[model samples]
Target: MSARDWQKSSFSGEGNACLYVSAPDNATIRLRESDEPDTILTTNPTALNALIRNAKAGRLDHLSKG
Candidate 1:
């Protein structure tokens, strides 16, 4: 794929510790952290939406605990 226009949330407020996202194609979504640009995480729209929904519902909060 060619270079993508990655976007970060405005709430991130200019820092190298935010998450960046890009939709290089209709079937794929890409994510990466500013502090680790070389490492990317890929997912589809459906899976991404599921994750977001679960997160907002607090269903994934247990994963963050030790």
Candidate 2:
């Protein structure tokens, strides 16, 4: 995808590192960190949605605490 194709998350803080995503096709979604745009993660719509839900619920916040 091109630079204009990726969209930044609205929850990202002002002038801080952020998360960006791009879905050029229905079969896949791409994720990248603003600080390291070269590294991208490819995932499906279903799995990505689940991850977003879990993250918003804090399920992925403290994995080492358990």
Candidate 3:
């Protein structure tokens, strides 16, 4: 599929350091930091949903600190 448009999270407004995502197809989700446009990471919908749920539950904050 063609590269899709990347959009930063609305919660991360006006920042150079933020997560950007391109949802080109339902089967895959692409993600990259705004500072690293050349490198793209892909994940499945199920894994992405789990990560989102973890973030909402504050499980990711522990990883960020260490």
Candidate 4:
């Protein structure tokens, strides 16, 4: 799949600084920052699921460090 079709997280705003994620395919998930498409990160479904779960559980709220 082409990166052009990937969707940016709802948290993304007007600025070009944002992260984008593509739907899972072949057990792998794709991630890249809008400002740096050349640097993509791939992760396994299990790990991705865990991260999502943690975020939902508020365990990852530290990401918004004040």
TM-score of each: 0.86, 0.78, 0.75, 0.67
| 10 residues in a row with least lDDT, candidate 1 | 1-10
Worst 10 residues of 3 by lDDT: 1-10
- Greater lDDT among 2 and 4 belongs to 2
Task: Kindly list the per-residue Cα lDDT of model 2 for residues 1-66, writing each as its tens digit.
Answer: 689999998878766489998999999899999889999999999998898899989998898577
What RMSD value applies to candidate 4?
A: 2.8
Record all residue pairs in model 3 with backbone atoms less than 3 Å apart, i.e. clashing: none
* Deviating ranges (above 4 Å) for candidate 2: 64-66
**Model 4 C-alpha lDDT per residue in residues 7-29, reported as the tens digit of each score:** 98999997888989886676878
Clashes of 1: 0
Q: Which candidate is the best by TM-score?
A: 1
lDDT tens digits, residues 21-64, model 1? 88988989998888888899999999999999999999999999
- lDDT (0-100) at residue 63 of candidate 2? 80
Task: Please name the candidate that would achieve the greatest lDDT relative to the true structure.
Answer: 2
TM-score for candidate 4, residues paired by index = 0.67
What's the number of clashes in each of the models? 0, 0, 0, 0
Candidate 3: lDDT over CA atoms?
A: 0.83
| Residue pairs whose backbone atoms clash in candidate 2 | none
Off by over 4 Å in 3: 1-4
Backbone clash total, candidate 3: 0
